[model samples]
Target: MRKIFLFMAAIISAFAISAQTQTIVIQGPNGKLMADLSVPSLNTNEKKTVAILMHGFGSNRHRPLLRAIYDKLSECGIGAIRFDFDGCGDSDGEFVDMTVPKEIADAKAVYEYVRDLPWVSDIYLIGHSQGGVVASMLAGELDKDAVKGVALLAPAAVLREDAIRGNTQGAKYDPITPPEYVELPSGIKIGRDYIVTAQTLPIYDAALQYQGPVLMLHGTSDIIVPYTYSLRYNDIYQNGSLRLIKGVDHSFNGYEKEAADIVANFFINTVNDYVL
Candidate 1:
């Protein structure tokens, strides 16, 4: 029987040693990325679609939103793999050394791993916050054929603007000549490499390359990365839709289930269409 998990931590704890889910590690650009793979039961000859779940800048795969999505996907007979970026969660590396490009590389590594899985017939990319930015660019790089669908939750294209303005999550610095690092109010220090690379990132340019279906969900009340970013994303993709949930914050604090259901359903429908 397949078990359904609720919270990120609880689900992870229950599946850590279960038969349906397994904890795996993938080597990323910076180091190891600890990941959890949850799949529904299937015949040996049957291949399944899987979604790669990416968390935000200061978050990990174990985030409640990501976990909720994982649960939904599993319940719908879709597989999901959520992992820590090189520097976050149980993965190896330092947070200060993390950057967008580095995270992209890490995502690429995960992509390579997932594509090679014998049981995975199709793949989708889903991300939140800066992770959404990574998913967009990565899909753009891989094109639509490689990634069947994409879902961006509060994509943070504003990172470039933040870099250009010499401010990141309230940490100020000189855009022209950034220091070794700047620490955010949350005490996570980002390196100069992060700011320099973010300033010139072709976020939308790369993301727009993927002509596949895309679903972007953002909250009007989000202050971290305005919902307008998602609107702009909706404007670029060859096929894309944006949903602005009123009153929901960036993290979807009280709307996790709603957001996750929308995302899971998008992927499920896309998979069904492709199979047909």
Candidate 2:
């Protein structure tokens, strides 16, 4: 009777350990950024690889698309961390102060935090839209050995072009004399610094510096960001591939599962290849 009770207790403990999620707060360039860290309940003692999920512009870390990817990665025995940018979601900061450079700094902070974990064997980045831009840049900036792979979904590299044209997010402003702040249709306020900084950023040049496996997914019907942008990335990356999803929007709305599976499989394969 005692042996049977002990066996049942051990099995329950193993089941509980298979999957776990935790709410964590990490310091960002501006302030605190809230995040959810999800780990698979694998019984192995080996160090695990983790993917950091980055949301699109004006979106929070808990956006449905991000959450869906996070769960899918966890189900695949991969861990994931999704966090809000400093000005968005539950993080501390004003949205008006947000910029591409600032968000890059925020991403670096999160990367450093995750990199120091003893249980993390490798790190990968999965970013959507603007977040994808940040991930690409950061992967380049970090030591080549630090980031094993990068996955971009409908990356919005058009911001740089829009800034140069003096029209960004449907608001026209003099590039040389932008206002201290401009409000968008959604009532989100962005500073002129954001425009000036984006205009001068060598996004592609910097992103292509990271020599790692890259996976880019874009939808043919994504009006916001043309699928050609991803094709351009594929051309730039030495070891990159692009997949065009048919008739889907920028958000991959109805094809969340497909997107998540692609990301998870890419990371899984990258990790396996690295190990071998």
Candidate 3:
């Protein structure tokens, strides 16, 4: 009985000190952006490495995918910070004001906030869908050594293609005279600046500049952003690898655990092999 009681106590103690997660607010380009920071309790005495997670268009940081990735990374002893874009979730801004450039700026702000942390030994960036584009572009713009690595999931590099056709969320308009605000099929309002900027944004060329290890994951059956987009990324990234999850959708809907595990392992392995 005493042995069994000790075993149960050990399990309970392990759970008590496994990980720590907290809600935080960071200053963004537009206003305050709500975020969650997760750190592994076991690494409290060591300088920790962190990954910043960015969400997709019309989505917030509290997304299930983001949450799953956050938990998984924390479980692997890495810190993670997932934040809302300036105009999404609990952040302060108007949804109509959202644009790729503005989101890049927002991400930069969050990056800066995390970069200066005394406990942080290395930094990595991960993004999904539109956020993946932002992550790729931002990684390219930063000093090569600034970010240890980058991971993109089903990046919407097609935004540039959509912009060239003057199509904003399935609604066509004259690129020359874009409406003040365009509503997407998801009911999110985007400004003309969003469409106009996409036409000129060089996602692929920009991503090529970041000469760091890159990992791209996409679902083979992704209808929104085809898997070919990630394939193109694999070709552009000098040190990148692409993994296709067979029969998975863009969001990896029912395969969240599998997708999260893959992503978490990629980061964990990269940190162990290179950053540490």
Candidate 1 achieves a global lDDT of 0.89
Give a tens-digit lDDT track for model 3, residues 220-254.
99988999999999998777878998999988798
Model 2 quality (TM-score): 0.91
> Runs in model 2 with CA error above 4 Å?
1-17, 42-45, 274-276
C-alpha lDDT of all candidate models, in order: 0.89, 0.87, 0.86
The segments of candidate 3 whose C-alpha lies over 4 angstroms from its true place after superposition are: 1-16, 42-45
- Model 2 poorest ten-residue lDDT run: 267-276
Better of 1 and 2 by lDDT: 1
Q: In candidate 2, which residue pairs clash?
A: 18-41
Displacement of the residue 139 alpha carbon in candidate 2, Å: 0.4
Worst 10 residues of 3 by lDDT: 267-276
lDDT of 2 by residue, 1-276 (tens): 999999876764554468699999999979999999987665556788889999989999888789888987777667899999989999999888899989999999999999988788888999999999999989888887888889999999988998888877787888888889878877888898898898998889989888789999999999988998899889998788789999999999988988988888888775458531
* Lowest summed lDDT window (length 10), candidate 1: 1-10
* Per-residue lDDT of 178 in model 2: 85
Error of 2 at 11 (Å): 15
Model 3 alpha-carbon miss at residue 134, Å: 0.8
